[model samples]
Target: MTTLLPPASTTPAPGGGACAAAATPAAAATRRPVVGSVHSWDLSTGVDGPGTRFVTFLSGCPLTCLYCHNPDTWRMRDGKRTTAADVVAEAGKYTRFIAAAGGGATVSGGEPLLQPVFTGELLHRFKHELGLHTALDTSGFLGVRATDALLRDTDLVLLDIKSWDRATYRKVTGRPLDPTLDFARRLADLDKEVHVRFVLVPGLTDAPDNIAGVAAFAATLGNVSRVDVLPFHKLGEAKWQALGRTFALHDTPCPTPEQVTSAKGVFETHGLYAV
Candidate 1:
């Protein structure tokens, strides 16, 4: 079973920390945004719904997931220094297209939570000024207390649940599981709309018992609008090679359609709806 730690007594304070303070002004200036690394944008990932989406891959993540696709995003000092407004302006050009098609901006990355100030500011502008649908794709590794302010204007959360078994979770992401589970539950309790995502890696997260465990836990979340079973792929292998890091899941096979079908069924059976 997933264990949830008691809600933290204090919420993380609003405004930028040293990291944000140091980066924001520069970002605000030349739009030469720098975080960990400023990699080129790939408009793919298929996360944005039905419309033209503007996605920003922020830098820095806490987890070292074995199957991490963007291992390059792990560092905290490599990206360009673009302000929140810079991102919004660029995304604004496509706003008309995104709106007509029912899509908007999605902030994804090395864990957008790692850059809370920038993410918060960006979302704030998106909602109050641009009036766009904002989506946050995160691992939920950053505890809820740290994220309360950030979620205020977020329209949707694409939460990635790495594992149901704590031990297995640590093996997969090199981090404890409780905090992530707590983050998930807190979002649910707050009535925040969320879509749970699980990457099904054969022999790792694909065991029937594990799938059932995840489904059972997800079922308890009253605000989960959908559960997505993302089949494992080797798309990030080359990226790892480019970054001079060993691809840990090199031998892990992608899940068969049967596995995806079966896993989806498990989620449905447990009362957690899947999309």
Candidate 2:
């Protein structure tokens, strides 16, 4: 999940260009403008990353998380075709405002790593060309797809550590929990700055043990600079209806303020900053 800690993609698209295969940094720079399936782009503050960020939401994701708010981004074909250059150019317009706000740019997805080459191109150009701080928001399921060159351009990572309990994690994302953990350890090894995100769903992911599990692991990472305890909401329920898919958590209530505070406390107890 792109920090929508949302389920996103890594399965290569069928067509050509960056969506098809990995490309070296030199290849990405010299090759024709890398292309990708993009959902939308917008400016937002607080949640995505530090400052006021120009966030790009790429298309396609492999997992089908039950509480996904952005179900519309689940498929590559559903998005409009665009190029990395075009996306960067769009972000370029906000460089001044973003800089003033102490923000930069973020490449999020259905999964950015799903389209590694295109994503890398966007990040590299965003940092090197636009002179902006860049972040990659992902679930880390496809962390293997993120080449070293890509990580070089990423100043921060907004990672969704959905659920620490294996069974709950699978029930929530329809995938095993290990890949995300593996990726977390890898990021720590690289000493990458990471902001861990956890969605506090009252019934789904609010168990004390689950929260403790995630908190303890994140504290061990040594590279996690912040933790965001996001509250669950029905904001994306309408999108699910439009997609003709049942919103599994339609009746699930958002986490209470107390629950959110307690969850944050768990991380704090582990010696990690939480908000």
Candidate 3:
């Protein structure tokens, strides 16, 4: 969560020259302009990707996860109407610095796939125009919305597996586990690079069998390069309270260092790198 707030203002940075080479005139003409509900944009490092990232948090999501900290982002109407070009322009302001740090651009949630077309445009422009590495941060629930072209533009994917057991998965995110597993398998088939994410909730998802289930599935995906064992935290409890919603996991304790280490060991046992 090392995030820097969006700059007060942005100017169009140099280089849309790549745009001409990126698409054919007829294709560009037929395509509708990309617009989206954007909650915010900022700079973040480490967890989001290999280097510092200009992360665009698109608004709206289908899931109502009990542990979601950014409840403010749940509704699409709450976000500002933004164009994909404008978002890429803002990221351009930091292109040099980001490239210097070996960082890239990340399209994050509410759920990037919630606005697939907009998310796709941003990824395409971020890579082709900005000449930066690009990552897609998504839950993979709407993986069907992601066209093959979108995945091609995305250099990496930060996919949240969340849970393994079907019932437990629904309890955590109010969604079925099948779609995520299906998406993981698809990414594997494509040989796409993926960093599988799991949030270790002490009483909820920390069960040995549940963790083992996730580890075992992820290990089967040849494309999985890393397993991020994130411990659940209540930092967003206030956001839930402020929004007048009861934070169900209000009293959920953050997993201890030992618990985290143990969970990491589970993935390592499956021959996957864990962090």
User: What is the lDDT of every predicted structure here?
Assistant: 0.74, 0.87, 0.86
TM-score order of candidates, top first: 2, 3, 1
Pairs clashing within candidate 2: 1-6, 8-61, 8-62, 8-110, 9-61, 9-110, 10-114
- Best-fitting candidate, scored by TM-score: 2
Residue-level lDDT of model 2, residues 28-76, one tens digit each, is 5565556778888889898899999999999999888988888899898
Q: Which ten residues in a row have the lowest lDDT in candidate 2?
A: 1-10
Q: Write the per-residue lDDT of candidate 1 for residues 140-229, one digit (tens) a residue.
A: 888553456568778888888878888889999998888878888888878988888998999898888888888898888888888888
Candidate 3's displacement at residue 265, Å, is: 0.2
**TM-score, every prediction:** 0.84, 0.91, 0.90
Please identify which of the two predictions, 1 or 3, would achieve the higher TM-score against the true structure.
3
Q: How accurate is candidate 2 locally (lDDT)?
A: 0.87
Q: What RMSD does each model have against the real structure?
A: 8.4, 4.9, 5.8
Which ranges of candidate 1 are over 4 A from the true structure? 1-45, 48-50
Clashes of each: 15, 7, 0
**Per-residue lDDT for 94 in model 2?**
90
Return model 3's CA RMSD, one decimal: 5.8
Candidate 1 lDDT (Cα, whole model)?
0.74
